[model samples]
Target: MDPTNSSTSLAFEVAVFNPSIIVGPVVLGALVDTCLFGCLVIQTYVYYANFANDHRAIRFTVAAVFATQIAHVMCVSATLWNTAVSAYDDPSKLQMLPLASAATILFTGITGALVESYFAFRLWNVSKKLLLPILSMVLCVIAQVVSLVITVQAFKTTSVAEFEVDQNTPITLALTSRVLCDLILTLSTAWYLKNQRSGYLRTTNMIDRLVLWTIETGLITRYDERRRSWRV
Candidate 1:
């Protein structure tokens, strides 16, 4: 080959190999997911080993959440493998949606809805209030339905760009409903707990700590969803 033509081809190939925009965030997300999964594993073990005497319904919920997490991680791993390894030489393949990506979205939505519903149930049990829990469940159901729609659209999409364009509305709805659900759960739980104050100083301190925990957990998930929505 002529030197000039060879250099031109090399530069073209280099440009084509650029995956930072598409694949970098995915790899980073997988890493973070794996780390969080590890933490979940530890938490699950502690729950089972120490709290074996908890209510059967609560135990079952914990098990279901753990199982969903496992599926979510597996789907994410497959997506990473398909994008970074199987399609390494074929950049065009990266533009297409992998089956695993759809599964990942479904499983992620299921996990979030499951956890939120469980918290909502707990709140109902504590406060004897029906409206807050009902609202939370409704929001969770909406988010779950939007996720299913997005997953189906992902299956039909020919390219990542097309998927983004087609599913933007559903994605936004899903994220918004989820964040709203979390906010409702957190605020309601905190409000109910605050009203349960007793005369003892120690009891008030404990309620304050519980409120803090509730807010932190809610905001963490809400912030994560907001970040994902912005990225979309």
Candidate 2:
């Protein structure tokens, strides 16, 4: 526990609390996320410059998305710092504090919910119906609530494995809801767009583009879900 020992004793070797590939992958992922966030920032700038000039609501949505993503990236960075440096020597520090995961999970859930809700709004606009969109929004809200519950359970549990076991029900519920929400949003949007396909070449091409965008968004959501569940 000596302050000087961290510098001399644990400086050269991987601590028992962490694995070899751990920090590398986290740092790499953080870098990738930051780069992607930068791209989002640029896109936000362009949207503000071009699209935001006319639509007040769209501009607000764009800003909300950007801010939520920024919060997510910042949480990711803080979690990395906690894992990589704060617990380098103190094994006790390696134990879950619940704060880090709590903040990150809450932020992630909010971001995912916002994105899905936006897509659901788009679908509602297209379908001119409230049934499916309302369902999707409800699922997204449930998932976010379940994520926060996981955070609370993690705080109550002692170890990571114990936390996972204790919260398995809520965890599975949250993830399942997320996946289902994504599927619904993607499929519904694509189906709606497909239905819009008319003999008119220009309109059909526009629907095609919208369908592609919907597919891409779903793929990204699936990837994020996998990454969240991949923890040891």
Candidate 3:
């Protein structure tokens, strides 16, 4: 083979792969993830500082979630480094999914499930209703299992194209379950809180604020999941 011809062919193939399409999103995601991690750190600090007298189970849960978040950040950072730096001139390397990338899926699912479970518990405590919280937990488990399957398939796949083709159904299922779970939690909590309003100005205001917060957070998460589905 003529050396020049071989080099030109590889370049053409790399161009077709469009590294920017992959690298751009990865970089943007990592930056957003890091920013969110910073927020979590601040929140964790505040929780420990102000809620020192919280129940042991609650404190332990907070600590565990914080640790998981740290690991998630590390995995995301590694994936970013691999995509933007380590794989910089190698299109084949870019095409293959990094181990860290797959690991991030697992970690993300874990962190999400834990947080959702905690919220579901809180909903159950306040509303004294078992159905919504139970449904939320079930959805969380489904999403988590789907994530695990995706991660495992990612490990087995040799390239991004292959993984996407194979995991499309699971990905859709996972996103759907997550959005549903968030929706249930948000609406149920807001409804229960609204019903608890005692007509006292101060107490009603507090409940109103909580309802707004729940709805806002739920919409944000649902929107995010929808975006992910669009991307997929």
Candidate 4:
């Protein structure tokens, strides 16, 4: 490669790696997640606030739920910021991208799993009838870990910089775990809402909408999963 041509090609790559373009979506997603999770936190607090005879466990549960959501939002935002800046700084460096990508993907899945576990706890508290939800969540965790291991192995391929990762690698694992987690959480909420001793209309509606948004965000609808969607 001619030195001058190589420099020009590298400059074009830098220009295409504009931080603003990709960062905008990340920031937007973070804000939307914040809004949804924040609303849930407030809703949970209000539900507990009116408890004239609140148990210690209920209070503790409320606190744990709030903390989990906050932690997830913060982790996601931090990951986005790190990934965006690193990409802008060195677009051609696959190693750097993978570092941030792996962290973001792993933490995001873990956060979602924790959220599902919390909901599972709530389901068990509400009804002894459905041990199935908790079982499903446990199975999902096992599957997610297996997928993550495969993705890590794929990244170990020599000259990953020249090799584009298909949707079947780490990204797929992350999204699959995320969707399954959302499904578990959504089912738990639906079960609770249906079986509530006295339903609160506002809270039920909010939970429904939030879970729907979660499903939409977590599931990669841009590509068809039923068909193998990849080009490399």
Candidate 5:
């Protein structure tokens, strides 16, 4: 090949692989997250509005989840703008914003911890045993620690690529742990609830519905967490 042609080809490749191109996908992911959060907000509002007669604890949990989700949405938007518009036309400035990124990560961890612990509370209610609930709580703690560490490390690094290269293990493990914990909680709760069925047609049907609801929520959230972590 001609030397000049080779040089031009190399330059083209370099330009194609700029940090901006990589950051584009992250921005898109953040936008999608914002949309999902909006949906969550709407759902929370409707639930609270319609179910005002629910237990105080249930209402409080719903409020807390929605609140944290709002915080996460705000932080993520700020971070996206900081990494995109404010730093536009400059690929080197494609760095993560420390405050926004950190806050977003912390919010996610707290949200997951809250969700898992709440279900652990349910498990406690069913079994009256401390061990299972405590185990689930421990997994949540570990997952959150890993998540926060990944966020802090990402901000400290120069680019997303670098962060992934350095922290991929923790990233994968954190998500895996989170999913496993949710699954365990889901299965255990469903099993215990199933055992409570008194064999009467009406009561058995009600228990079946509860089991279905638990499985559905469990799988949906588990899938969502996996998707979010993969994006990160």
Candidate 6:
């Protein structure tokens, strides 16, 4: 092959691969997260407006969701931009952006987990032994630790290139943590619902269903995986 032709072909390959690296996962992840958060906000407000008396818990949950949304956007944007730039230039510029994004995401994850975990505890309050509830709580804590460690480590590294190449490891770990946390809470809530006494009625029922559905959509829903298959 001619040297000039070879050089041009390699350049074209790098350009194509570089943009794909930035656009593919980052865009999909951002869109999914943004839409989910928008739905969360709408559902949160509806619940809040319906139950004006129980504003404290609703408000706190909404705040955490909003914070998580903001962090998600920041991380998504920064990551894509950093990835795009790093494709052609020195990788050092991406240093602090990932760190900051990671911190925000960690905060969001922890706060959100706490909200769900607290609600789970409240539901299981009547349990005599509390063993199941305690175990659920421990799972949430451990999941949070896993998420924090993977996320922070992924961000703190010098070159995001390696992190991005091996992105599945951390992303899978983080998702696993989120899923496990949600599963434990969901199961606990289901047990609570089954064991709920006759005295629970009216708005309490609605609240239970609403919270259940919210967590269901945010975590357990297979919408993204389906989309991935369609694209493939």
lDDT of 1 at 32: 100
User: How much lDDT does candidate 2 score?
Assistant: 0.77
Candidate 1 residue pairs that clash: none
Cα lDDT listed for each candidate: 0.89, 0.77, 0.89, 0.61, 0.81, 0.64
Clash count for candidate 1 is: 0
The parts of candidate 1 lying over 4 Å away from their true place are 1-19, 197-232
Candidate 6 matches the true fold with a TM-score of 0.59
Candidate 3 accuracy as TM-score? 0.78
- Scored by Cα lDDT, where does model 1 land? 0.89
Q: Per-residue alpha-carbon lDDT of model 2 for 1-232, expressed as tens digits? A: 7889766544433333244445576678778889999999999888777775567776777788898888878877887787678867864555454365556677778778878988999999989999989999899999989998876766566454445446779888999999999999999999988777644667779899999999999999999999989963
Q: What TM-score fits each model?
A: 0.77, 0.70, 0.78, 0.48, 0.68, 0.59
Each candidate's clash count? 0, 0, 0, 0, 0, 0
Question: Candidate 6 — which residues are off by over 4 angstroms?
Answer: 1-22, 55-58, 83-101, 126-129, 164-177, 195-232
Which lDDT value does model 2 have at 11? 47
lDDT by residue (tens digit), candidate 3, 1-232: 9999988855755555556688999999999999999999999999999999999999988998999989999999999999989988876698878999888998889888988999999999989989999999999999999999998998787677557667889999999999999999999998888777654667879999999999999999999999999999
The residue pairs that clash in candidate 5, if any, are none
**lDDT comparison, 2 vs 6, better candidate:** 2
What would the per-residue lDDT of candidate 4 be over residues 71-182, giving only the tens digit for each residue? 6677667756665665566644423334434444454545555566666666666666566566757756765685566446545543233223443465565566657656
* CA-only RMSD, every prediction: 19.3, 19.8, 18.8, 21.9, 18.9, 19.7
Candidate 6 lDDT by residue in tens digits, 2-99: 99998885565444344344446665776786787688779877877787677586567666766666676676666666655553476435322355
Better of 1 and 3 by TM-score: 3
Name the candidate that leads on TM-score: 3
Instruction: Give the RMSD in angstroms, all C-alphas superposed, for model 3.
Output: 18.8
Please, what are the lDDT tens digits per residue for candidate 1 over residues 132-199?
A: 99999999999999999898888787567667667888999999999999999999998887776543
